[model samples]
Target: MKTYTRITLSLLTILSLSACKNEEITPNRGKVKFETVSISSKLAGRIEKIYVQEGQLVKQGDTLALIDIPEVNAKLIQAEGAITSAQGQLDMAFNGATSEQLSQIDGQLNAAKAQMDFAQESFNRLQNMFQDSLVSQQQFDEVKMKLSMAKAQVSGLQAKRDEVTKGTRFEQIEQAKGQLDRAQGAKQEVLLAADERYVIAPTDMSIETISLEEGELLTPGYALFNGYKTNGVYFRFTIPESRIYDYNVGNTLTIMNPYTKDETQAKIIAIKQLAQYADITSTSPLYELSESIYELKVVPTSDISGQKFFNNATVLIKK
Candidate 1:
């Protein structure tokens, strides 16, 4: 009877010890979470098209939507016309007066020359008459004045003709050319703005949320879509502040998805210096943290396919 009692006591103690050992071996597991960001529109216009739907996977530079660009196109065309007109004016200014204009100025100059010659001959005859006392000094003086006026008119006409024959000044031509170039540049800028109406995907991203739809008038800075990288989803988890001293960058970790029973091996890429506290009332459960927890970034060593890891999903980590 004594032996039997001793055996029974030993068995009970062993069982209790086993239970304590089991409790000690079980690790502290925490839920997995993801970070999200929202993408917004850069320009304001009507949504002409939406190329992506909710949960659609997209690569970088993919067109997401387009704005109505008819107005922009019209402005570009108008600018182009203005540029053409400016260019033609610039060309004319640079080329100077045409042959026909020069010819007309030349004829006027020749007529002035003929008038001056006739006046000079008359003045010479008057001078001879005055010297011989055949005509009065006042008559000779009148003829001399006529000759001087004709000579001055001829000189003025010759200068005017020379000006017409000379091509446009270099400075004036350059100014006109610059105006035309500016107009052309304005047209190009409008075209570029029109092209910007179409929104494009950034790269290798999955569309998480779509806010706008076709034909909707979107204002500037409107929320368009939310996206995440598709290659490998990052698992955001936190470690207890007590154990933070033991963990460092490049530390290996094991993560398990409790929902899917999927396991992934990862490494500690970063340890957030600041502590994250709980916001219990918020709808987002992942960001809500308990006190004494520090945020951590873990990148999976392997790929996860078709598995939806819930925010705050349980992960079994073996450090």
Candidate 2:
């Protein structure tokens, strides 16, 4: 019995020392990660249709949803009207007065000239009477006033005729051109707003959520969570500042999946220090509370095609 007890004690002691040595030899730990993107609408409106479901893999430029904005429709109509009106104004500026308008001005000028001729003859007769004392001074003065008024009317009509014959002013033409450009620009803006009503994917990503259902109001800039891109897979390691010297950019190392024990070669792509306010979990919390933490990014150089890994999955760095 004493011999059996001694042998058991020795075996236990050897196992305890081996466990400590294995623990010391363990490699740095990291997590698998991928780039995530958010999807959203730039305009506020009711969601009319949803083309994708949660967890659906989508390609770049795919239409995800449709929105109905009453304001945008109204603005489009208004823009069309404005464009028509502006075009008419520009044509008028370029083509000058119409034929009917010129004809009317000419008729008025002819009538005014006839009336002025009659008034001039009457004024001449009245002047003769006043000089010969054939009538009262007040009577002659009234006739003179009539003649003056008729002459002024004829001059005004002649000026109108001349203006009608002349083409549009240069300043007026420029003003019309400006108005036309403004209307066209407004129409383009409306067209862009119409395009925004159709939600399109900006990049290749997996749909993580469908936040709003059909017929629900979607506010401008509201986010619908989209998952990480599959091809942009990488790993992130939160290492203590003291151990950062062991890794650097462009260093190739082998990384292993903790559960599957599958290994892949990855190259260090980037190393950045975490923000001062950022909180990170390390393999061991033996460092000071105020000690800085760093994030090491690595990308697989070997073909990881057959291997399946999820974002934030545990991975170990092999020295």
Candidate 3:
């Protein structure tokens, strides 16, 4: 009975020692991560339709959603009308007055000259009568005023004809050109706003969340889509200050998926102290309260293009 008791005690001792050894060699826990991104609109509009759903993978330039901005359409129409009016004004400046306008000015000038000749003749006759005492002072003054008015009218018509013959001034033409350019620039801006109605994917990414549904109003600068870049996978580990010296930036290490037992090579790209307790990414509280925690950012050394990594998934660092 003593011999059997000794053997049983020896077996228990070996098992206990083995279990302790396994615990001591356990790998450091970490998490798989990816760089996140948010897509937003530059202008406010109602969501007309969503082309992609959550968890859908999208390529660069893909239309993710369509927005209904009725104001944009109206503004575009206004821009077009402004452009047309500006163009017409510019053409008029370049072409100047038509032949018909010049002929009309000439006809008016001829009529004004005929009236001036008649007024001058009457003024001369009144002057002679006044000298002979045949006309009163008031009558002579009235005839003199008529002659002066006729002369002024002839001078105004002559000046107008000269202006029309000279055509538009250089300054006027330049002003019209500027107006046309301004109108064209406004139209370009409106077209750009129109393009904003279609929300496009800036890069290849996986959609993680949609902030609004179809028919919902989205305000300017509001993030409509939250997603992750397709090739932004990495690993994050929180290490207490006591064990931080074991890892350094640029050091190569083996990372493993705890559930799948899959392994990959990675390099420690960064090591920074955590500013807050919430910043720690470790699954379990494996450090003391008084100890400072640090984070390790690791990037895969080998091509991980074919591997799938989920955000916040459990990953381990192999020693």
Candidate 4:
């Protein structure tokens, strides 16, 4: 009987020592977090209005603020004018010359022909006079030059008449069409710039801040840090190297919501060794001097859905 009692005491002592060792390294809960994104304007502008306050829920493409881009408005006006002018030029190319213009050109050509005839008759008379020694060589040459000038004028007028009647050349029409296309493209570009006037949410998130007040300038690449996405809720747990053996990339664990006391099964999505010490946001940071830490990314399983989790909220991980 004494031997039996001694064996039972030894077993209890071993169990007690094991319990104490496990207690020295307790499992920790990570924070419920959603990815944060920066909200910014592609074009720099002054804020016209703020539509949201801090902590407001917004969906993707929702207008958070309005920016007044003075340059964009002016560009739109210029683009529209260019489009109108290009359209007019294209129409002129297609329609050719008007009836009045054709009639005027024909009249000029007829006048040129009359002058040519009169000059030819005088030249013939001068030729005869020269042959009879009735006029100087200079006089004959003067009449000959007048006839040539009249003939050249008639030819020029005839060419002008043909061009007016034949409409615009193929090259001219193609050039006009290209100009119209260019104008339309410019107008589209201006409209896209105008769209940048609204500061928009990139995803479904809660507003974390409003960096600028009304009438203040907002430069490019500024972060509004719209709070984490609601639908893409996930938890990030920082586990020190001492306790990292409990988790891998695909391990499943039950996470308890500290606020609601509700438990949800989550699967580990990713595991990464944190490089920076300042990035550690672990519950029970286990402030060791120089030991490396790791981060475990987890998401709720499909069987557990529809839970609204808040950012940085405590969630116990059951490893």
Best model number under TM-score: 3
In order, the Cα lDDT scores of the candidates are 0.78, 0.86, 0.91, 0.85
Candidate 4 C-alpha lDDT tens digits along 1-319 = 9999999999999999998865643378689887776688888888899999888889898888888899987888899999999999999999999999898998999999999999999999999999999999999999999999999999999998888788899999999999999999999999999888887888888888777788888888776445667677788889888888877789888888766768888899899998865534454466655557899999888654556677788888653
For 108-145, candidate 2 gives per-residue lDDT tens digits of: 88888898899889989989988999989999988889
Candidates' RMSD to native: 7.7, 5.6, 5.6, 6.5
True-structure lDDT of candidate 3: 0.91
**Cα-based lDDT at residue 305, candidate 4:** 56
Clashes of each: 6, 0, 0, 0
- Whichever of 3 and 4 has more lDDT, that candidate is 3
Ranking according to lDDT, highest score first: 3, 2, 4, 1
Pick by lDDT: which candidate is best?
3
| Cα misplacement distance, residue 137 of candidate 1 (Å) | 21
Candidate 3 local Cα displacement, residue 180, angstroms: 1.5
Q: List the residue pairs that clash in candidate 2.
A: none
RMSD to native, candidate 4: 6.5
Model 4 weakest lDDT span, ten residues long: 277-286
Model 4 steric clash pairs: none
TM-score of each: 0.67, 0.77, 0.78, 0.75
Model 2 Cα RMSD, 1 decimal: 5.6
For residues 1-319, what per-residue lDDT tens digits would candidate 1 score against the true structure? 9999999999999999998865533255766655554666666788888888988878778888878756787888889898999988898887788889888888888898898899999999988889999999889989999899999988898887776577777888888988899998899889788778988776677788888788888887877888766664666666677777777889877776655667787888888866444466356777645557676788787666656765556776653
